[model samples]
Target chain A: MTERIVVSPGDLLGDGVFETLHLRPSGPWLLEEHLARLVRSSSILEMPEPPVDRIRSAISDLSVSSGALRVIYTRSGVLNVSVSTIPATVLRERREGVRVLTADLGFTVRKPPPWSLSAAKSLSYASNFAARRWAARQGADDVVWLSTEGYVLEAPTASVVWLDGGVLCTVPPEEAGILPGITAEHLLSLAGPAGLGAAQRMITGAELSRAGAIWLTSSLRGLAEVVELDGVARDRSPWTPRLLDLLGF
Target chain B: MTERIVVSPGDLLGDGVFETLHLRPSGPWLLEEHLARLVRSSSILEMPEPPVDRIRSAISDLSVSSGALRVIYTRSGVLNVSVSTIPATVLRERREGVRVLTADLGFTVRKPPPWSLSAAKSLSYASNFAARRWAARQGADDVVWLSTEGYVLEAPTASVVWLDGGVLCTVPPEEAGILPGITAEHLLSLAGPAGLGAAQRMITGAELSRAGAIWLTSSLRGLAEVVELDGVARDRSPWTPRLLDLLGF
Candidate 1:
């Protein structure tokens, strides 16, 4: 059943922050990290700290074995928690990989605005959705946004991770001025046990294209390998399943 | 009484478009223009055409003589019309003038992304709100964004207009890729009758400071003269009230 919430018209203005989590039979994966990011996002928006305990209670009340769980907190102090079945497209992207396109975002990371919410997982996601739609129109499954300087920033909804030699690398969130990816960071944390070096580096889109393998990482999709970029197809990387298993997907 | 709308969680993602109008005793001011822009904005977001007849009926049903009227349409096809008391701050700004700050938006208008919604008044207004908060922190009433190239763009919630000798000017919406301001456009259309020539020109932040007068124009605010720019005070221009009246504020 679709869940609905009563909200003031002001609450619909995208003046809020949100977190999406992968709900598993075990529990919501990376709950602490997602919650912490939610607080950080709210601070960036100058909103009051979210009620974490209430969010936890709302999550606890859900009886679904596994699904997608979302927690939203608006500037007007409206908090909503809802659970829905994961979309089949997300699962398909995880298993079959995604064809990706690269586009200049026409913005620089060097000097972001003082009130920049780039680091926040704010609810103003229209542009993100539009960019993905643009990708679909271009016959690709996703897009990686590059700063005007040609540096790879991230995908609209995911973090860009690439294998460079024996190292696994992703953009440093602080340096890129983007939302920190919980899933990508967690995967990097476990890289050592998987016999790969993990690092955060600013790589240009051209440089990214030449990497051994590339993937877009997020909560629901886990990680979708980039099988094609800018119309060029790439061979499947041997580490896809290994890393997926390493992250317990 | 506070108005409430029942919405699904997805409706809050700022994946929507909206227009604000000055409600008047005569009727909702500039109703047709606003509804037309709403359609254009929805097209930009790739949403289906808004139910114009429904919105018209909603506006006609409002009995409030005067207030701020907002029409919102989400990607999920939710249409909402709400009327609320105009904030005292808005009235104060219109009458007392506003101190403005100019800040680099860290983006170029030269080539906005293909999926750019910069020209649309999308519901994703977190950054716009944040910019104003940043201005307040700087002891200013509002802010005007500058493209990375230093060209003045628009205020967070309004358009920048200025007087250059006997001519009135504003940034061309198409060239600057910012949301076109209905209030500013209407005022410009009547400029000839007000004994002023009007033109849309790209002006830099530095150059704008030398203009005879400047104001931020929006639907509800009408026109708020810039009392100060970047902490430098300017003498009140006699055109402030004249332009406000010309726009039928």
Candidate 2:
């Protein structure tokens, strides 16, 4: 059942932080990392510390074995918890990979505003959704945002992860001033165990196209391989299955 | 009584557009302009056309004589109409003017992305609120965002307006890619009747500080003069009360 939440109109102004986690039969995957990121996001918004104990208790009471679990905390200290079925698109993209369009985001990675919350998982996500919608209109499944200098930054709702030889690389969150994707970080940590090296580096859009493999990493989608970039079809990579299996997708 | 709204988790994601209008004893101020902007905002987000007649009907059903009336429309076709008391700070600022800090918004006026919603009143307002919070922390009441090239843009929640020589001037919404301020435009339309010239011009932050007078124009606040900018005090402009009276505030 779709859950409904009661909120003040002020809450609708997008002054809040949120976390979406993949709920497994055992429990929420990477609950600790997600919670830690939630705290960091709140700090970036200058919000008061969230009530961690209350949040844990709320999660513990959930009866759903698997789905998407969302926790939202508004600037006015209002908290909401809800569970929803995963969208069919998420599953399809994970299985068949995604066609991504590369577009200039018109942002400079080096010069975010002093009060920039670009690194925060703030509720103000209209731009992100708009970018994906634009991709869909262009006959692509998703979009990868590039900085003004042509550096591949990240995806609309995910982090850009690429494989170069035996090295697994993703953009450095702090340097790029983007939300540190929990799923991407976790996947990179497993690279060494999978006989690969992990690295964080910035690459131009043209250079990114030459990588061994490209994937957009997020919580629910796990890793959606970039099967086609900017209308250019790419050969399937062997690492796709291995990386997905290592992440237990 | 404070009103509560029931919304889905998707509604809190900030993928929506909204309008806030001043409710007076007679009726909502600039109702048509506000509704027009709402439609423009929805278009920018690529949402289906909003049910305008329904919104008008809902506003007519409002019982309160004076307050802040808000209409929110999410990308998922959810529409919410609510009324609430304006914050005391808005009144205080309107009465005594505002102390504003100038900061670079890290945006280039000329390079907005294809899917940019900067001109729309989207629900992605966390950055706007964050900028205001940063100003308050710095002992100011508001902030004026400057483009990366140092040209004056707009305030977090208002449009920048000023008196240059004998002309009333504002930033061109189309050229600057900022939200079209209904209040500012209406005020400028009255400039001729008030025996003043009106214009849309671009100026640098330094030039803005040297204007004869500066103000932030919005619905509820009407006009909040910038009495102090970047910790530099300026004498109160005699035009403040005259403009306020002209606007019926």
Residue-level lDDT of model 1, residues B100-150, one tens digit each, is 999999999998999999999899999999999999999999999999999
lDDT of 2 by residue, A188-249 (tens): 99998899999999899999999999999888999999999999999989998888988889
Error (Å) of candidate 1 at residue A84 is 0.9
- DockQ for candidate 1: 0.94
Question: What does the lDDT read for residue A5 in candidate 1?
Answer: 93
In candidate 1, list every pair of residues with a backbone clash.
none
lDDT of 2 by residue, B66-124 (tens): 98989998887878888889999999999999999999887888788888999999998
In Å, residue B128's CA in model 1 sits off its true spot by 0.4
DockQ of each: 0.94, 0.80
Q: Rate the local accuracy (lDDT) of all candidates.
A: 0.94, 0.91
Could you give the interface RMSD of each candidate, to one decimal?
0.5, 1.1
Model 1 interface CAPRI class: high
